[model samples]
Target: MRHHSTQIPESSKLSWMLLPTKKNTDTVQSTTDVLIKAGYIHQSQSGIYTLMPLAQRVVTKITQIITEEMERVGGQRMSMPSLLGPEAWKKTGRLESTGSELFTLTDRKGAQHILAPTHEEEVTSIVKSMVRSYRQYPLRLFQVTRKFRDETRPRAGLLRAREFIMKDMYSFDIDQQSAISTFHAVEQAYRACFDRLGVPYVVAEADSGNIGGELSKEFHFVSAAGEDTVLTCKCGYAANEERARGRGASGADMYEVEGSEQRVVVPAMRRPNLLKIKQAWPDCGELTLEHRKSGEEVASLGQMIALDEVCADGDYLVDAAVDGLAVEGIDNFSNVEVGDWHTAQSGDACCKCSTGTLESQTAIEVGHIFYLGDKYSKALDLLVQHDGKRQPVQMGCYGIGVSRVLQAAAECSSSSRGLRWPVSIAPYLATLVPLENNMEHATSVFATLSNICVNGARVFANNVIVDDRSYLSPGFKLHDAQLLGIPITVVLGQKFKQSGHVEVQLRVPRLEIATCVAGVDVTGDGYEYKAFVHVDQLAEFLVCALEGQF
Candidate 1:
């Protein structure tokens, strides 16, 4: 793990990845682009990518954390097939239901096979054959493997790729109560895993989405570049837009009644909630609602009005003709049209706690947990004998999109300088930079770093990198250091040569994260914004910082 500048790839020198978007920049580049230009990944196909060595190192650390957390929660590691037969999927109706996302292929013998996007069918098949006695009622089996899906459009780097790494765990239990208990246990493990990653995240209610389940939640990293829209309340109620529900506006919002000179105002169900409207009018299956902007498809975001810009009172009072009547969308308002209208807005009262208003933001989904009753077990015939009667085993499935979490960490953390990472998953813990053409000085500091240890292990050698490219300028090295995301940087320069001190810089530090201190020989140049340490007390300083004591 000891790396020198020569050992690293040149693609990593693309500092252009961190370029900030200027005013009126029409296109916004996301973390995916940043990762590509920075040489962490390479696109092999339209929706497939190859992780570079540095990216692989970071991915390995993330996998290790997930594996440790999985083991902590009583999960036994095991591998399942990436290619699955269609029988079980057919039985579960997922063969047809899974639809386009499924990757299907035919062998030379003309037998069809599927590249699994998930393993519920395969895992259930395993349990059906192996576990039957109620004594073995509770079981948790997991695996870290590559998964495939035929994405219509894959963007956002590793966040939504056709092929990616995933950690999937399946839980089996004898009864509903036991299954729910197992679900909570796995939930805790997910929380612990994310907590260790050091990025802020949210646990929001979620829809099962192609993967069938009864109870579900999503673990999200809030980011402007995220594709999923999430609605949250200060009261702790959060859900993805697909599953989020807001109470109907008390009164029909003011609008111009189409085909008439009358402006109307009344309480009405928005076209945005067309499905809910259909629930009230079961027979009106053909009903359709449109946005007031020329009545285009209302199902999209063009219909959502910002609550903040609207009336502060939540009562959108308008001086209409006063002849407007209150009626739901079902009472023959299908052809009714108007100008721009309103739907769920940020300031709308939260459905969970009325005191809090619903606010919305986009977020990346890195993990998902589902309480998947007996659907899979029943379809796959995973029955266990209990009290002399066989019953379908209760089950649940949990998944962490391993690669998605990696890129999401970058998206959540990167400043204009470049990508950032949590200490636990950074490619390396520290970097050694020789501020002059002093390879000898760098070698000396590297030896000290290499000698540093904790619990009798050579942790530093395994987590430290020396910038040995003597041809590169000190400023260039420092600039690259910011983009590399190695937390502790030691600089050997004129000051170090004069006083046996090497300046240290801690990138993007927060005082509250950890509690440990080490002395610096002296402060850095006055022109600099901050000086982390002078690489003084080197062993104690780096050991603590790399161990998340920064």
Candidate 2:
């Protein structure tokens, strides 16, 4: 029952009636259009936007959810400077690795600064100075603030914005095992936050890109407009294509090839590296090889056999690690079986289980968690004493794109009718509209509903809106409410004046309305209803409906 005052006050010089007067564009027709038309956000540039009153309300609710989850996991909230010096990035070598992606500028004194896309370097530096002993082994710090990224192509409104809000957290542990435990704790917290948001998301193994780490996982919201390709197997194996791997054949599938010896060269020898080889040699055919002996080099196969004796007593080159091949006496060596070594395709065999097959889908990356190990700590010399010896601290980082969640939620819940937000995150739980002839009755109804309480919390006052603009028709107001995605709409129309029954439109589907109000005629779609209730009964019904009591 935490109470937060509404941003917009009654006497304030702001009103939803002025939304129609704002500038809008019809060129882009998506949920972003509905947001703009509804006056939630205004685009300042290609990827930058100004959050209007309505949009701010939604963002606030989202921030609150993240904050609650973070606090539950003992994450101490703090704020770091957005403008960072080049010293820390240089020490970590990210200044060169990040290249153009790191926005850089020269200060008046000729010192370089970067608009931090992330706070890894800064957080490590801060913890380095503060933590010196193993007593502070598992330290977790988090911040919910704006971040700047130099996106090559910024599009889809807030989904790929240049300036956005993010919840970034850093964890420090005394050892790798403790760091892994901390990582799982943060992962659970993220799951709770996403569940409260009510968005369909998947956690998949991911490549630790510029943010160097040993293991990485991304939380992706499944949507058609997503940018990342996620591969999932029925056997419960999931990973981003960048880090996906296929199941290699076991000893039972090994066979001998009777032909001239051909050399196969794969640049990298890591799990993800095989996928890269496949991309470079798409035309190369697959080769089934026996498992290699201990300490055997994949590159030594070319030296072991001659051209005539192809059937050698050695492992086959299903995948190999060689730079290039040149036969000693032959003019050309073209009989090699060079297949894809790097990428796992959509139909690749599931590495985890035999019965499952791999499938791919596009998804929006809403959050990422990385087991950083000692990459940053060692680079920055963030040592903590343990057992009378100083060692680099194990670290982990977790991030959630706060602004991207807003766009993703809209994409997930949008429909031909309008945008419908979840009750927990909607800007307003409901909109109260008074028909032109029923203004007096609507005023009394608004007061009664606003004073309603659910679990010691006021249900409406700041959470409900009264569309009392007399100049607009009831139909237009209703349309506007639907467009804005308000969960419920209480209309004091002809039905209320004639039969003392109000029409409550439930924009969200699968909600229990009948259980809240007895004998209420709910529509087949579970979206519209006619409820006959006295003033006191009306308050009770709204409390139950908004609180999801059914």
lDDT per residue (tens digit) for residues 278-309 in model 2: 34444434443423322133234443211211
Please report how far candidate 1 places residue 297 from its true position, in Å: 26
Candidate 1 on 419-462: residue-level lDDT in tens?
Answer: 66667788876777877656566666776877787777776566
TM-score of each: 0.79, 0.81
> Which pairs of residues collide in candidate 1?
251-267, 252-266, 252-267, 252-268
Model 1 lDDT, residue 20, Cα: 28
Q: Please give the distance, in angstroms, between residue 209's alpha carbon in candidate 2 and its true position after superposition.
A: 0.7
User: Model 1, residue 470: displacement in angstroms?
Assistant: 3.3
Model 2 Cα displacement at 276 (Å)? 5.5
